[model samples]
Target: MNIDDILAAAESEAPDTRTVKVCVNPAVARKRAALLEALKQAKELDAKASTTEERLGAAPAPTTEHADRAQAELEAFDDEVLKSLITLKFTRLDGERWSNLTAANPMRVDVALDRNYGYNFDAVSKTAAMLTGVRLSDDGEELLTPEQWDRLFKRLSGHDFRLIIDAVWTLNEYAPSQHIEALVKGFGAA
Candidate 1:
């Protein structure tokens, strides 16, 4: 029976005065069961729809741990600076043909470092120098100064291995001489 019929039957039953116990109609019971099943199915479908919508919605941003792990891996990735270092040949900038001299690529390294650890200019600068043997200059231009340039060639010299290799590489690409001079002159002494 339809809902209207069931409701009408229920309304009729409510007004009955001769109630020792009213006999339930089996057909009405069946209709009620069918209605319940339909309601259940509707509820299930609504739940499914809500779940799908949630999945489709913009995901919650990654946790700090997820971000940190990704950043650590990226900073540790050798390819970002390694490939560039391989192609870069020494140019006679200021009449110096140093093999380690190359322009800094700051994008990947900076992103990696900034994402993982809080920015430490000294640490980032040193890391870039170690990894790339060059770094972005202070003005965000090509490497030119003797201080950073020499830092890459000197401290990182003969030592191709370091924990912060990527940072060193970025430093090399940026301001190699300045880094070198800083190390040699001593921090704040220069």
Candidate 2:
């Protein structure tokens, strides 16, 4: 009803249940809004271009394609420069523990582990068990079965699987970042 009641209600909610709202400085907020609008416009234009090309069976303009490629190359270089790779070297026993965990679980724990990133440090590994779950299929309609997952896991080499294992472990320790998230899931999609 009043300011005091509103404050009380917010406090009463569980910390995890609380809805966080970040207020950027007004100038920064304006810039962010403009950037978002530009991103939307760019995406729409790309979609239109793709549709036109598909319908016409025509190639994209060479200059436009070349520019896009150049920009992508610059962005990739920037990403590489900004990111630092972390290699988690483990002894045989530790490696075995990691491999065993991966054999049993999918990377479903990413979302939960991410929640613990900035706040709860203690409940990481405990939550890692949650990774043993399902992923949406190519159609995003159904969950993959355990057998399906086992087959997929079997296809991975030791190095590929370990990359996943390290990525999962790092998620528990570090504050969230896109680079870290990419390590777990990869560049875009499978």
Candidate 3:
């Protein structure tokens, strides 16, 4: 072999630095570019949203007037609720009165307790037919109409809520030691 041939055989080949291979269809090239642009925009939007969320996380301080008004209203409602709880009376002993109260106006309990704490309507209705309906006994002597029962039950629920609030308020606002002593004496808590 000639000297030139020997030199050529010893030389390293250059790397291929080319980016394009076979040319893509124009439509395909356009779609790929559009997709890349959309991806860039989506990333930018995500960044903006994160910044906005950070800004929204910190709340402004409340005004004293508004705060005082809300507290006063809540306290007044609690006082009234405590009174209602003290006064509510449930009388179910008189047969004629119970009949009058329950049987006069028929009431059907449509909405029922959700599954979180109690059974749904389908399960409860199967056990107690009267839970889903209010009807008269064969002998018609009534105590309260269905409407009356509804109002009475609503007031009873209000009383329950108020009493709970009053209990909490008494413990927190009154003498803690006295409240604890009363609770210990009354409820026999260990």
| Residue 17 in candidate 3, Cα distance off native in Å | 11
Structure candidate 3, residue pairs in collision: 97-143, 99-142, 99-143, 100-142, 100-143, 100-144, 101-143, 101-144
Question: Which 10-residue span in candidate 1 carries the lowest summed lDDT?
Answer: 15-24
lDDT of each: 0.40, 0.43, 0.38
Clashes of 3: 8
Candidates 1 and 2: which is better by TM-score? 2
TM-score for model 1? 0.20
Name the regions of candidate 2 deviating beyond 4 angstroms.
1-138, 176-190
Residue 91 accuracy (lDDT) in model 1: 21
TM-score head-to-head 2 vs 3, winner: 2
Query: Candidate 3, residues 1-190: lDDT per residue as tens digits?
Result: 9998886874554311111111113334444455556555655665566566667884443224433444454555454343332221121122243334334433444543333313232222211221222323335433455565455434444334334333322322234457568989898784
Please name the candidate that would achieve the greatest lDDT relative to the true structure: 2
RMSD of each: 37.6, 20.2, 38.8
TM-score of each candidate? 0.20, 0.24, 0.23
Best by TM-score: 2
